[model samples]
Structure formats: C-alpha cells, structure tokens
Target: MKPWILGLTGGIGSGKTAVAQAFIDRGVHTVDADHAARWVVEPGRPALTKIVEHFGAEILQADGTLDRAALRQRIFAVPEERRWLEALLHPLIGQEIASVLAHAESPYAILVSPLLIESGQHRLTQRVLVVDAPEALQIERTMARDSANEEQVRAIVKAQADREERLRHAHDVLSNDRDLAWLDREVERLHTFYLSLRGGQA
Candidate 1:
C-alpha cells in the first residue's frame, strides 16, 4: 500500500524545518520539495540545461552551479521570468518528489514544502499540516536567518498565501509562536497522533 503522506507547510521563517526535523528524529520518512527542486537543477541535469538555455550562462556561478540568489532575484522581479522558470522546473520537481515518496519504507511519510498549497502539492497528501507563526515573527526570523532586509522579507511574505488562508486549509496546525521546548512537546504530541492514525489505517 502507498504510505500515508502528510503535507507539511509554512511561510518563510515559520519554523517548518524545525518541525520536520522533529519528525525526522522520530524516524518518519520525509521528502522535502526544496531538496527535490535543487536535485532537478543539479549541474548536468536536463532541468539545469534548460534553465541555462532560457536564462543564459550568466545565471551560473564560476563552479558551473546555478546562481540561486541571482535566479531568485530575477524571478521575484519579473513575473514572466518566474512563470517560465516554474513551468520548466515544477514538473521535474514533482516527478522527483513522487519517485522519492514511492520508495518510503516508513508507515507514513512527510512531504515538507513551503509552497505546498500554492504549488498544489497538498493534493498529493492525506492531510495538510501547517506550521504557523505571527507575521511579524516570520519577518523577524527571516531577516535574521536569511540576512535579508525587512523590505525583502516582507515582499516574500506578501507573495505567499496569507496566514489566515493557510490555517483555513490546514488539517493540523502547529503553532510555533513559543519556545523550542514548547515546540518539542507539540511535535511529540503530533507524532503520537500520526502513529495512531497509521495504526488505524493498517
């Protein structure tokens, strides 16, 4: 049988990675969409070749790797460019994610993605689990973690689905507005819940 997939998502700096790490610690098989995205565009990959063809070789670093920061800036600044890139990469990334999940040996698996809802990845899962935090906190955390200024972080936040919309669509909500200890407890609780769910399905 196909393993149950929990679609995990959050806006930038919403502590999604922390929650995913907690699940990983518990031996949950996890497939990260971001990792799949990178994998598709790795050097010598067809996706990278197509990207270079469309965006030019300058988008590559000296080591011949994609200049991710430059690509990010370009996509954010130009809607057409972003659409073109997404059109090229999204299918490849989706195929890679599917292949990874198919090999999952755990009773269930986690598909962690920042754009789970936006990219419609939630459709691939049995449930949607959102890691939520206040917008101000998200901005602050992103600024510190990404070394991005307030304006840039705010723009990213704005580009994403609003907090209310994400929560509205969630089957589970993990509030990340508190300390790590609190977050740990919540993760533990959810882990138990997921295990119980898997048992029931089995």
Candidate 2:
C-alpha cells in the first residue's frame, strides 16, 4: 500500500527545499518531484531520447545531459513547448515518485513538489503543507539563486498558483518569510503534529 503522505509545496523560491530539508533533518523520508523530473531525463533514458528527438542535440550538454538552463529558456519563451515538455515528463515523474513512496518505511512520507497543486499531485497525499512567502521576496530569491533576470523570475512566479489559492487548499501553512531560526522551530512543531497524525490513523 502507498504510505501516508504529506504534500509539501510552494511557489518558486519560497524556500520549499529548506522546509523539506528540515523534515529530512528529523529523519523523514522525502520524495522530491523536481529530482524525479531530472531523473527521467538523464542521458540514455527514454524521456531524454524523446526530448532530443524533439528539441535536437542543442538541448543536451557536452556530457549528453539535458542542458537544463537552455531548455528552461526555450520553454519560458514558448508556452506550447512548456506544455509539451510537461506532458512528457509529468507521468514518468509521477510513476517514479509513487514507486518510492509506496515502499517507504517511514511513519509517513513527505512529497515535495513546486507544482503539487497545479499538476494535481496533491491527490497523492493525505494532507497539503504550503510554504509561503511574499511574491516580491520569491522573485528576489529566485533571481539571486538562479542568476535569472527579474522579468524571467517574475514570469515563473506568475505561472505558479498564487498565494491565496495555495492557502485555500493547504491543510497547514509554513510561513517562510522570516529567519531560518523561526523555520527551524516551526519544523519542530509540525514534525510533532505529523507524528501524532500517523498514530491517529493507526
């Protein structure tokens, strides 16, 4: 059977990885959708072969890996390309995530996905935990981390579910607009709560 799951999500640059790491620090088994997406496109993978056939060798690196930055730029410029890529990768990533989660021995597992709500991945979990930050802050963080321009970063943010929609679907919200010390404490608090939920389900 699939394990009990907590779907953790946020807008790009909302510190979803930080929150997921905190859960990992507590020894939770976590599956990341982004990581799964990359896995399906590794060199020699069927998805990678298809992407090469569609986008040409320019989409690949010298090492034959997907040139993620180049592909990101192309898709960002063309909505149709983005949709096509999503259609090809989403199902493969879902299968990989499901396989990992089903065998998870943890009391419960955490599924972290930036597109959890948008792609309907929340259906795989019993609960949704949203990591939220202001839009400006998300833009700033993405620019700093990705070396992306404000216009591009803002475009990515606009593509995600807005703050209110995420909150409306959230069973729990982790506000990450502040200090990491605060984040540390909040993770502790939520960790205890999730443990109790697993017990209750028993």
lDDT per residue as tens, model 2, 1-202? 3458999999999999999999999988999998888889988789999999999999999988999999999998999999999999888988989988888887889999988988988888889999999888998899999999999998888878888889998989988999999999999999888887862242
Writing each residue's lDDT as its tens digit, candidate 1 over 30-141 gives: 9999999999999989999988998899999999999999999999899999999989888888899989999998778999999998888877788889999999999999
For candidate 1, give the lDDT of residue 108.
Answer: 82
Single out the weakest 10-residue window by summed lDDT for candidate 2. Answer: 193-202
Clashes of 1: 0
Distance from true position, residue 74, model 1, in Å? 4.0
- Candidate 2: clashing residue pairs, number: 0
| Model 1 error, position 70 (Å) | 3.6
Which lDDT values do the candidates have, in the order given? Answer: 0.90, 0.89
Q: Note each model's CA RMSD in angstroms.
A: 2.3, 2.6
Question: Best lDDT goes to which candidate?
Answer: 1
